[model samples]
Target: MVSTAAFLRRAFACAAFALVSAAHADLKVGIDLSSTGPAAVIGITSKNAIQMWPATIAGQKAQYIVLDDGTDPGKAVANIRKLIDEDHVDVIVGPNITPAALAALDPVAASQTPMITLIGSASVVEPQEGKRVWAFKMAQTDGAMADVMTRYMANHGVKTVAFIGFADSYGDSWLNEFKRFAELRHIRLVATERFNRNDASVTGQVLKLIAAKPDAVLVAGAGTPAALPQRTLVERGFKGPIYQTHGIATPEFIRLGGKEVEGTLFPTQPVVVARTLPADHPAKKAALAFVTAYEDKYGPGSVTQFAGDAAGVYPRLEDAVARALKKAQPGTVQFRVALREELEHAHELVVPNGVVNTSAKDHVGLDQRASVMGAIRGGKFVFISE
Candidate 1:
């Protein structure tokens, strides 16, 4: 019943440990995030980040077993099965995206595998609290994002929200939660529109919504892929405020839309420049260290601090994986399930950004309890956790 990924991982780790027993301990990690089709960048970042962990840990490298889920849940299941049954992975970190995350969640959960995911879907973990017991999120949820944006807007006395989301689950999920959160806060619900993830422009939608005069537009699109709306806002000359969900690419938005993308903002992991950042910063010097380390490992121009987190989260997950490995008793499975109790609602350790206080009762690592807010200033992220 062990996952092929887990199986492969064990074999690889054992062989690696045997080969390098003196100065380093061996670990086998399975990456099923992206190895397949177009999502290669995500997979590459994920794998590279995970690989960098052991590189940074003790100059010891873990053997990695990688597979791409191909954006198909079925393919995802098959790939996970291969990793579980074939690779014998000790624990699994990701399949990325909602569908793949969901596809592998149950199967891996049943196998008592520990899965650290960044997927924001609340349902993936069920019960929202202690559902799978083996699952954890390094990524914040849509509701967490909604709460941040809505509360900020409410505090600022802004109302009338028009949703400019993609026609997909990720977007739709945010749209639903945003509306729900907005309603709870007495914010007016205006209109909603969709855009293509491929090439269709959101300029028309921005104009249409601008004509409606919503106080602010809420956007939901893929990382860097959702730069369309900001571009739209500029081309059409809408002066209203813009709010973004977590996924949009800040650098791409800025690069593509220039001044229009300047003020656009969303929730993201904290990034600070040590020298320039305030000493009171919660993310502090370590956050800046992550950026420097990431650049050193990946080479310059690999990813902006915006999506740098899109990739930076991997090391955080690696810490969770290593932590799981330690607790994996001699007889215990040491799979995702065991790690779930330790990771999901059990611990609060600093990853790249801030401390992730997750537990069995709280699945999202941000603690469903606190929200971290940041604004892009002069091209850098400034924490406003107030």
Candidate 2:
């Protein structure tokens, strides 16, 4: 995780440049999010999420370049460099995947370009002890998500738990985390299963886990494919409580699994469930309003709230870039430096998530409340503290 303090310190170490003359001034921003191919399903949602927010909110013209990452890290790094060195973009909005986000971390921070991304790995923030200020997640982390799950499990008397993971970067990361936290929290991890992302049948694994009879099963893959076992259990009439990471708990699973996913409980940010937050809570309100607008723009009946994670991060990415631009003195170096500096805001402000107290000391621009327990109710996500 990027420690806020160390990142801020390094951000200051990367000095700013003198600005170019005021003539051809246009705030050109570059976006390297997944916009096409398999990732587009998420990229388009995030793209709209970024655009829906008022651009000038952070003080910058919304001139942008959205690139298709093709879900490749090397390509993401190359594109990000081009945007900074060749395109001379004032800031950046993305490269959503954590591995892809990892590829660009050193490049953007070393180049001193302030950028935000939809990453879930803590390595991006800490990046080997020193802080990489320019990198951050528009979404929450898997470890933190694990923390919530463990706490919930402990609270609910769920002692023996099973984990079904995709064997991908996200799944592996969290599976390891869940084991570690399980030990710490005294929760016995009864069984574990892994499946390929392309596997259409997880019946064998589901049967294996069913035999284990875990108090609860946690699914950690990315899409409907990961929800296979969760769905199959229902087919076999095995209906113990089911838990999952935010990724697989989409409406697509509901449409794909039909009744199987109906009662599956998943951990997700509460922002999707509320139409507006309580008047006293701005973040809650922001999440509700954002979800409402998103549903209005693209009918919710057919969409999954988890997809919104992609959409929701872009604007946050843009805002950081905009701030960096306004404070950047001149030239690529200075602007990049400013981008790095302005992006560190846990001390002064809180964005959509709550208590985001990141700084040079903390690189994880997140807090505990960024995650909440959610369930699919009547075919839609319903957030409940329980």
Best by lDDT: 2
Error of 1 at 242 (Å): 1.4
| Model 1 CA RMSD to the hidden true structure, in angstroms | 6.8
CA lDDT for candidate 1: 0.59
Give the lDDT of residue 159 in candidate 2: 88
Least well predicted 10-residue stretch by lDDT in candidate 1:
1-10
lDDT (Cα, 0-100) at 382 in candidate 1: 47
In the range 133-232, model 2's lDDT, one tens digit per residue, is 6665556777888888788888888889888887666677879888988888898988888987667788888888889988888887765665677777
Off by over 4 Å in 1: 1-26, 35-43, 55-61, 70-74, 128-131, 272-278, 299-337, 344-346, 368-370, 376-386
- The CA lDDT of each predicted structure is 0.59, 0.64
Listed in order, each prediction's TM-score against the native is 0.78, 0.82
TM-score for candidate 1, residues paired by index: 0.78
Q: Which number leads on TM-score? A: 2
